[model samples]
Structure formats: structure tokens, C-alpha cells
Target: MDELAAFLRTRRARVLPETVGIPTDARRRVSGLRREEVAHLSGVSVDYYVRLEQGRARQPSAQVLDALARALGLDGVEREHLHRLAHRPAHAPRRASAARPRPELLRVLDLVADAPAFLIDHRMTVLAANRLADLLYGRRLQGLNIARHVFLSEEGRALFADWEACTLDTVGHLRLSAGHHPDDPELAALIGELAMRSDRFRRLWVRADVRTRTHGRKTYQHPSVGPLEVHQENFALPDATGTELVVQSAAPGTAAHDNLRLLASLGATPAPSAGGGCPAEGGDRGGALPEEVA
Candidate 1:
């Protein structure tokens, strides 16, 4: 279910009405173009698109895959994701899922020069964060699971300006991911830990809130970089179950963008240093939403 839900959300977000030349008007009820519009543009049947989104159609042929890639206006990374989901096979018993990021993925994360990037499993742990990620958010993030830290730790609260909203939203997004990998023991243990540790998490988990995280703005109070506003992009890893390459970028020329680039250049960051320096520059803390709302 997690695999299916994730694929559907990814496919839907990758497409836009304007990408296919559809009029952007008040008639739009959903986030992106309608399923029928996507099918019509891609030369597939509406029923097929619906089936695919609903996760009922498991096997998409090569031709269908090509059509979806075109219709969704997927970039190189997204196109690869479409192919991966199309060919996903039902898992067999005794599956020993990975607790770390893939080696190839770590290489790719290092290759990213501009923004801090890393890979996170379903529970959103800091499995493989790069140097930049370590430098910026690394101080408070050390040895901490993202979900646990966000809801339980004071550092997490300080890092995020809108603490409650962001915590709730991220929890919801994690819920959606959990549904697809119910049998994955790592994910299960993560959920169990949260349930016991945080009362807020316990309530949210009981409500069964699930959300597909699409594009959005996230505010982080970086120790060195001060305040940074980044656009969060999650890309699925090829042949990896419940893994995503989470990349974050700031709008060009902003204070955060400039400071972050400088911080990255300095390099060789120490682990969780002291001092309350604000860098004398930052992003506006108002109106930044949580990781949910897709």
C-alpha cells in the first residue's frame, strides 16, 4: 500500500495543467490536471490512469510506461521513478530490508553541490545526510531520528519556527508512508517508539492521518546559516523500497541561500557546537506551513 500510494502521489504531482497546455482556471478542483486529461494527452485510457492511481493495475507495459512519462511531464529522475513503480513486484517472505542508504545513493547525495541533501527511510531518520546537511542541521540532528526529534526534543522545536504545525504535518506524511510498508519491521519499530515517547504522536497515530508530501516551503533555523527557507523535493530511489532522496533548495539571492553556500564552502564542521550566533540575516518566520498539505 505504501508503494502504491507513494507512486500515485508522485505521478500526480509530476504533472501540471499548464505542462500539458491546459487552461489554469477556477475549474481546477485538484492540485494537478485531471486523470482524464492526463490519459487524453498521453494517449492512454482514463480507466487505465484511474486504475494506476488506485494501485489496482500492477503491471504497466513498456508502451504504457512511455505514455505516462510523457503525460506526467516527468523529468529524468521522475521518469525513472515511473519505470520503477511500474515494474514493482510483490515482496516474498523473510525480507531483510535495509537500515541504511544505498552506496550509490550516498554518491549521488555527495554530488549535489548547491543545497543540503540526504536520504531518509519511512520514519525519516537521518540515515545518510551529506556534509552540507550535517553542517547546517547537523548539530541538533546528530544521533536523532527525525520523527522522534521533531516531536520530542527541544532542539527540534527551536529548529522549526512553527513547531506544532510542522510536527503534526510531518507525522501525517510519515503515516502515509507507513501504510505502504506495514510489514517492514524498521518502520513498525519507529512507529512504536514514537507512540510510547510522545503523547502528541500517540494521538496523531490513533487518528490514522496520512498525507502525500508534495512540493512546499520549509523553514529551518540553521545554527550557522541562521534562518533558511528551502523547497523540499523527494525523489524515490530506484530499486529501493521506502527510500527517497530528499533535496532542499533555497530561492536564489536570499540571505539564507547566500549564507548556506558560504557555510558549505567553509567545510569541516564540528559536531553540535555551542554559541547563539544568528549570522545577522535570515528568512521571514511567518506563514511557513508544515511538511503536510499536499
Candidate 2:
């Protein structure tokens, strides 16, 4: 199915029948709201909605798009995304080179010395990170790809206390990124690799979940400092459509904060080499660390 169609279907699947006052029926075979139900709710005919899903309909009017958005219960980000997919010109050519984070932005990351800060592109490539973030993530962040590390590396599972939630959120954010840059070859390759190497990633990808990371809390089972909870904040880089600076910190005066300070202290010290060096407790085992929390 086309991108717009697949996205609509997936969003439809997320809404329960009872959510919109639709009576649940035992005879229903499909998950979430059926196409007919959506058609009724959106004030469109079943055939029209079917054609939209089948990629046969004309460019939908803004009114129609808004109606459909409400019917699907899309959040602000998701709603904007739906409009973009519907209105985006087909097969548009893209720049040959992927955009990188600016040096000034890297300087900004440096200024946030006390917190774990890093820059990532839409594809979750760790463009650069502060020393604290480098120490926090270790080898996994070194390879530059966050999703790959989370799904493919054993250390990823050990780092995250809520591994499944982290994986799902990562996949969802990737999906959102894909919608914005549908023609990016590297993004396509990353998705293809994950789908091939990880069964969990494959399942989540097919669901077409989309999420935007702004601010959230995450629990990390830090190998060095034990368990810690940190607040993650993401800032979009100005003039950089696909790159973001992510900063993670714990509340002051909390144990988590003390652990974060300890991490910062460790980061200040020189890292030990693989042979005869002070290895991080349950560190990446020589694998690259994943990107900052999404």
C-alpha cells in the first residue's frame, strides 16, 4: 500500500470502537475501527475512503484531510504529518547529501557539560555527543546509529529497564521520520536492515506507529551507577529540518542526580582501552552505543 494509505489504516487501527461511541460487534473481524465506520465518522462515503486508502483518490481537500484527522484522533504532530503525506508531491527529488548538525550546535552541546547531550539526525545517527553522553552510552553510541544498537545489540537490552517500551518508541519515532523524508536512501537502508535482523523491529515497523520525541522521562539501568531515572528533552536544530539535540538529566537533590554527577565525573577521566583498561560495568562490549533516548 502507499504511504498515505498505510498510515491511515494504522491510525485507524489504533482507535477502539468504544472510543467514538461506536457499538462493538462480535462479528467484527478487523482490529480497531473498520473502514465503513471511519467513513461514517468522517462524513465520507465508503467508496471514497476506500479509494483514498487504495491510492486512487485525488489530492484530498484540506477540509477532507481535517475531517479524517479528527476521525483518526491524531495528535498535533501526527495531524501535521498526515497533511504532509497527503499533500507531498509524488517522487520528489532530494539532495544528494544528507544534512549534518552545525558546528555551533555542537558547541551548544558542549556548553551543556553537566548533562548528557548529543545530536542526532532524523535517522537517529549520533552525529556528535558531549563527553558525558559519550561516557554514558560508551561504544554503542560510537557507531552512530541508535535504532540499530537498540534492536541488534545485547547491551541495549541491559541498558534499558523498560526495553520493550524503548524499542517501540524508537521504532515509532523512526516511522515518523520516514514520513518526513520518504526518499532518504540511508533511512530506507536502516529500516531494511532492522527489519531483516530483528524480529521485534519487523513487527513494530509493520504497525506504522508514529511518534515525536519532545520531552519525556526514561529509566536507565546504568552499568556503572546502577538504576537512574532521567528527564529527556529534545530540541530541534534551527535550519536543520532533521537534526535534533537531545539532553538528559535527573532532578537535583535526587539519588538519580547524584548518579548523573558521578557519570559526569567518570566522563571527565580518560576512557580505558579494551585491553588491560578499566572496562565499563556491562558496557557495550566493544559495540557502538545507541543514540540518546528518543
Candidate 3:
């Protein structure tokens, strides 16, 4: 299960004592370097590296992979690959270059400022999201990854009373996208990671139930507004790499709409992202969704 053992062995073999600026005081016994030396140089506990070398743990956390990558002196590409391997996500895979949305696609977003809007690939990467789009999703998490927030953030998790239900919906949406664009490297990587870490992810993925998410109603408790109901709209970008636009808004002329307007006037910016999850991207033209996720 620990497929990393072989790679880790090879890496240790290549790094000689003098090459990494480490002094080898003990008599070398093995063909490769000592485990302690590698552990020391890499800033990880010797036990952890040994566990990795022994293939004791099948899945390591992202932070652990980051530490190992630094210890191994891996470059950017190699480091990314290590993460890809460690997480073994279903949607992210090797890529030459990820597809960036075109300018006209952004122009269309500019027209939808009244609506809260954001774009997600099968990997749940927010390739492009407008200001208001960010407002709805960005506030709750330190970073944006619809999947990350769904699992990692407490407030984000609270949005859904039934965690399993939301998780299933998210993975199912991804599985459906994979059917449409099987070659997409990002999607492949995402699926792989979820499959490895979450049993629920794996179970839902196995069902092969494909569903395109579009219009729907959801209830959310906004930090500022208390609680609000929103109608969601999802549109798949035909030419884009299975990118879906998720938009949200409250009903017209209601009290919720007024509350959303009040919230928007607070000068909320798009989560300090390129688009910054602000209202300008599309915050409640009146009242919007629970949160934006870009």
C-alpha cells in the first residue's frame, strides 16, 4: 500500500553525505545513506521517514508531504508530484498547463454582478470567480477549494446539517464531470485524492451516478444575516474544460434581499483573491447564497 517506499529509497540513495552539506561521522553500513541523516536534513522526525520508507502508513497528510518534499530537496514540479502521490486524489493528475478561462468568459461574469457567482472545475478548483462570487464562498475559509472548505472548515461544514449528504452531492457532481471530460488532468487528480482519503468519497464515486448541478434551493446561516434561503443556478461553460458556474441569490423584494444588500454595502471584497470574492463579481443583486467559495 505504501507505494512511496521505492521512490523514497531511490531518493535517499542519490543524496550522498557531502552533497547535501551534511557531515557523516558514523561508519556507513548500507548502500544508501542513514535514515537519521535524511530525517535530520529534511526537518522531520526519524520515525516518520522510517514509517514512510517502510510504507507503514498508506496515506499521509498534505503537510507531511510538504515536509518530506523539503527534506528531499525536491523542486517545484517534484514537490507537486509528491503531493499528487501522497494524496492520491481522483481529479488532480500531471498537467502541462491548466486551462485558464478566457477574457470573454470573464466579461460575461461582469454582466452577472447582481448574482453571486463562481466557477469550479471537476477538481473543485476555482479557476475564475467574480467579486460577489467570492463574497458568498470566500469568507469562511483561509483558502478556497470547495472541497477543502466542505471538509476542513468548521463554519463551512455547518452549512449542511447532513454532512454525508453534501459530500455525496459534491463527489457525484465531480464524477459526472469526469464522464464528460475524462482526460482532464485536474479532474483526475481530484478524484484520486478523494478516493484515497475519504471512504465516503470512494463509495459515492463507485455508484457512477452522474448529475449536473444547476438550479436548486438551499438554506444557509450567514454570519451577518443569521439565516437565509437562496435559489442556486449552475451553468456549465460549453467550451471550457468542464467548468461550471455556480450562482446564488435570495427571492426578490423580500426581507432577506434587503439584508443581503446591507451585507454587501459592508464593503466586502472577494476573499483577497485575483477576483477577490467581492460583490462586484456578483453579490446578492438583492440577497445571495450562504457564502461564496473562490
Candidate 4:
């Protein structure tokens, strides 16, 4: 189903006929109030409502949306989602730029040694990651896309304690990204790939949910460190549109915090150097020390 239609159907299903003053009857086969009932409640014609649900209607006016919102008993978030689905242009510009972190941002990331931090774009592509984050996610994060990992990689299922919740949140964020950057071919490609590979992803995508998760608590089952819970916060970068710096922290004095510190230390340690100094001119410096030391 199309986004608008799916959104409307889902919202309608959450409301009961009896609660809306519509007499519920045993003969009613529908799960919730029917399209006709919603039309009557919203003061719109039955045909118009049906057309709107079928994606045949034009962009709904604010008044119409408000009426429908009232009819569906939509909360503030749901109402805003309804408006976005109804008003988004059918076709948007196809040009989408890749999100890149600035050098200054990398410096900032270096300063954040106590927490696991990374930067991600609208597509949840990891633009940059600090040592702690790299250690926490391990080699599985090489794909650099969180959504792809969640749906396509077995590691994702083992990493997150609440896998279903994580997947739902990821999907909702992607839906919001789609709304903001409808013309991004990369974003479209990512969605198409996930839809093809994951039945769960396809089902959630059709729900048309939109959410921006800036702060939340996450539990990870680290292979080496065992279970750890951390509070995650995302900060938007003004210089980079559709890019966010994400940091995960555990409360001070907690065991989780200590575990994270250990993880960071493990990641920060450089590999053993085969050669101590810079090699002779044109000679290979296999595992040589970095330039900062030389």
C-alpha cells in the first residue's frame, strides 16, 4: 500500500467506533470504524474519503487534514505525520549530496575519548567513528550502514538486546529520512535493498511511521564485554545537512561505564610495530610507527 493510505488505515485501526459515538454492531466486519464512518465523523463525503485513502485525492487542505486528524483521534506526532504524507510533493529534485564530516568535527570526535561516538548520515551510513565506537561495533560495522546491518547481518541480531525495538526505530528513522530527502537515489536504493532482503523490513515500511530519535537508552550484548546499557544522544551538525553525531554513554560510577572504558582502551591500542622507525627511501615500512612519532 502507498504511504498515505497505509498511514490512514493504521491510524483508523487504532480508534474504536464506540469511543467515537458510532454505534458498534455485531454485523460490522471491519476491525475499527469503517471509511464511511470516518467520513461522516469528519464531515467529508464517503467518496472523497475513499478516494483519499486510495491515493486518488489531491493534496488535502489544512482544514481537511485537521478534520481527519480529529476523526482519527491522532496525537500531535501522528497529526504531523498525516500532514507530511498528505502535502509532500509527488516528485522532488533527484540530486542528493553525500554527507561528509568536517575536519573540525573529526577533532571533536577525538576529544570525546570517554564515550562511544560516531557520525551518521540520513541513510544511517557511518561517516566517522571514534575508537570506542569501533571497538563496540567491531568489524561487523564495516558495512557502515546501520539499517543494512539491522536487516541483512546476523551480527545485528546478536548485538542488540531488544532487536525488534531497534529495527522498528531504525525503520521509523528511515521513513523520516525518506520524507526529508525523497529524491535521494542512494536512500531509495537502500530502502529497495532492505525490502528485498527482509520481510520484516517490508512490513514495517508499509506502516508509514516517522520518528526522529535523538535520545534513548540502548542495550548491547557485546561479545567480549557481555551486556551493557548506555544512554545514546544524537546531535545534528549544522555544517552537514542530514548528518548527526551520535554518542553513547553510561552513567558514571557504573559497571557499564567501566566496561566501556575498557573497550575504548582496547580499541585505542596500536598494533605491534614490525619496524620501529621510518624505512629507507622507497623501502616498504610494513607496520612502521606513525608519522607523529617519526
Q: lDDT of all the models against the reference?
A: 0.65, 0.78, 0.61, 0.76
lDDT string, candidate 3, 1-294, tens digits: 333565566557756677777666667666556788888876778998898889886677787777776666666645654554565554543433334555676677767766666666556656566666555553522125676555545656665545676776786567545544545675676678767766667776664444456788766666665565677888876753556777778777976566666656656564433322221222332222333222
Off by over 4 Å in 4: 95-97, 140-143, 269-294
TM-score, cand. 2 vs. native: 0.87
* Higher-ranked by TM-score: 2 or 4: 2
> For model 2, which pairs clash?
139-288, 139-289, 140-288, 140-289, 140-290, 141-288, 141-289
Q: Which TM-score value belongs to model 4?
A: 0.84
Name model 3 segments beyond 4 Å from true: 1-97, 140-143, 161-163, 272-294
TM-scores for all candidates?
0.58, 0.87, 0.53, 0.84
| Candidate 1, number of clashes | 2
Instruction: Please give the ranking of all candidate structures by TM-score, highest first, separated by commas.
Output: 2, 4, 1, 3
Q: Of models 1 and 4, which has the larger lDDT?
A: 4
Checking candidate 4 for backbone clashes, the offending pairs are none
Q: Report the lDDT of model 1 for residue 229.
A: 80
Candidate 1 vs candidate 3: which has greater lDDT?
1
lDDT per residue for candidate 4 within 1-294, as digits (tens), equals: 467777888778778888998887678888887998999999999999999999899788999999999999987766887888788887866644444455677777779988888877788877667667767876423226788777777767788889999999999889888777777898998899889989999999886767788899999998878888999999976642577889999999998998887776665442222221212111121223221110
Query: Cα lDDT for residue 5, model 4?
Result: 78
Residue 20 of model 3, lDDT score: 71
Per-candidate RMSD vs. true structure? 11.4, 5.5, 16.6, 7.9
Q: Could you give candidate 1's per-residue lDDT for residues 125-185 as a string of tens digits?
A: 6556667776776553323467766776676668886777787787776766554554568
